[model samples]
Target: MWHSPSRRRREAGAANMTRAGRTQDQRWVATAEGEHLRGRRKRDTKPEVTLRKAVHRLGLRFRLQRKVAPRCTADFVLPRHRVAVFVDGCFWHGCPDHSPEEFRGPNAALWEEKIETNRERDRRNTTQAAEAGWIVVRIWECEIRRNVEEAAQRVAETTGSNEAPRRRRPAMPK
Candidate 1:
């Protein structure tokens, strides 16, 4: 079967448009000649990198993007702690407050459906991990950006096995 150039271009344009409105940069459009290209990182974003670095600085070791099971991968996994951290992109993961009213451009319906599917998958993964005795933590990109240290601290506290010491009551004033 043969496809016309206009149709192919339209399809490609639609695909590109799907990610257009989000704050992410599109560097691959200039390189790819076809509609479908594999192995390209959609949002190998900087916030995630910064968060990872911060976690590392806190002396935390983790597995990056480890596959949990069929059709799911945890963004960061601490096997010993049974903790999984997911650095969710505000746009792609449908952050209730941060996601745009509509996706990058005109293909809002498609993007909405795609994002909803991602959310459903995330829910399923969380459920599966919980069933397997893992603590799942999801941090939005915006949250990390707003207060990376706090977010890191939460992750550390959640993943750390050490029990927090109880506070003693102050002695009665004389």
Candidate 2:
């Protein structure tokens, strides 16, 4: 196929037009919403770390960001007690208490759908983990920030049971 000079130039320019006018390579688009989304941390988040530290100080050590079942990697995984902890952000998770103005910005529908999907996924994951004999501990971000000690206490109470800590696998010979 013979390519005209104008056709080549047109094609070169098309490469720069990204989806939703987003920058190439997913770089920051220099918008408030864009910056907000980019700032979302997966692990080692402040709330997650605070809760982890609080729980640790209470002598309830657990694995961080480990999968106890398929498609469900908890923020804190207590294999001994078969517990999976998830620290959820209010805004991202669509907390009703959050200010409505937060979701009133550009692409509001997209944000609502995203948050709804997150809620549904959380429900499904909780059920799946329960069926697999694991307890799910969900702490709201505000709750963790407001009272980390209370969250730690909840974890302790949930895992502190008459049943001994059950090992997931047999101990290897040392």
Candidate 3:
């Protein structure tokens, strides 16, 4: 019984798989939880898009996912104002309003650790950006969902571009 090179390599790697079927390098996650986590987008999420639209509506232009400091990439950056804005997911960033205080599952400990690490990294990144002379704004997902205009306003204000929001003109009857 001869196996192809690819098959042999796969077989060799199988030895590194944990009982949960994830490779040693991969963190263990419950099946349902894993699916949800995998489906999450790292960028251009709905809240981010809505915030972007609102910011643009406020007459502020920004660059998306720009790196303003070493190892720090902001979701969007107002280059002229030297502002770096980050839109963080509630659960991923351990939001006080949404993130669970205690995770429950086989890998519950890992989940808690991961969330904490995310928060630490977020703080570190914000500090790094600030140290590099960039104004940093961190917005929670719930805040954006609740009132995107407010979130956008916060960003605009941080950039010192708090111009009056553009108003729509009423339609004229023919």
Candidate 4:
């Protein structure tokens, strides 16, 4: 059957609408919120980097963004110790101490639902990793910022490798 030109054009345009287009079409309470959401980082965030450096200083090695289980990617993992670490943002992860109990504005319900969904996903990821024989260590952004050393210590303690291994330096060439 022959299709009309306008119908064909509409179909073509719809086909051209990709994920970026869908994201652009998302409804935000304010333009600034959209910008903020766009600016959010999925990996290598400041807290994650700080925690990684602190852990490194303790002489621990880890793989970044490794999947310990299906749909579960840890920020970093100590394969040797079978430990997976997730650096979660307080607001995003719905921190009991930091996150607000209720939200306001047009997208208030949406925000609450989003946070609840995030918390549920977090629980699922933790359980999946645990079932896969990986110890999950979740560190809150506030906790890291308040005392990164303490967070690092917690990770080290979880791995049961608090002491840094000695490294041998290369001798000077003759």
Question: If both were scored by lDDT, which would come out higher, candidate 2 or candidate 3?
Answer: 3
Every candidate's lDDT:
0.73, 0.78, 0.86, 0.88
Each candidate's clash count:
1, 0, 0, 0
**lDDT (10s digit) by residue, model 1, range 1-174:** 788655665756644433343221333223243134334354446777888888776777788887665666788787878888888888778899998776554444666787799899889988887777788988998999999988887888897666453456899999
Question: What are the per-residue Cα lDDT tens digits for candidate 2 across 9-92?
Answer: 566675654545443544433367677777678889999999988887767769988876799888888788898999888877
Stretches of model 4 off by over 4 angstroms after superposition: 1-30, 166-168
Q: Model 4 reaches what TM-score against the true structure?
A: 0.83
Check candidate 3 and list the clashing pairs: none
- Name the candidate that leads on lDDT: 4
lDDT of 4 by residue, 1-174 (tens): 898655665666765443434333344333577567857999999999999999988899889999999999999999999999999999989999999999986668778888899999999999999999999999999999999999999999999865666576999899
Give, for candidate 3, the lowest lDDT window spanning 10 residues: 16-25
**Which residue pairs of candidate 1 clash?**
21-104
Q: Each candidate's root-mean-square deviation in Å?
A: 11.6, 6.9, 5.4, 4.0
Model 1 TM-score (2 dp) = 0.66
lDDT of 3 by residue, 31-137 (tens): 77686786788999988999999999888888999998888899999898999999999988999999998988678888888888998999899889999999999
Model 1 ranges with Cα > 4 A deviation: 1-44, 103-105, 162-174
Best by TM-score: 4
Per-model TM-score on C-alpha atoms? 0.66, 0.73, 0.80, 0.83
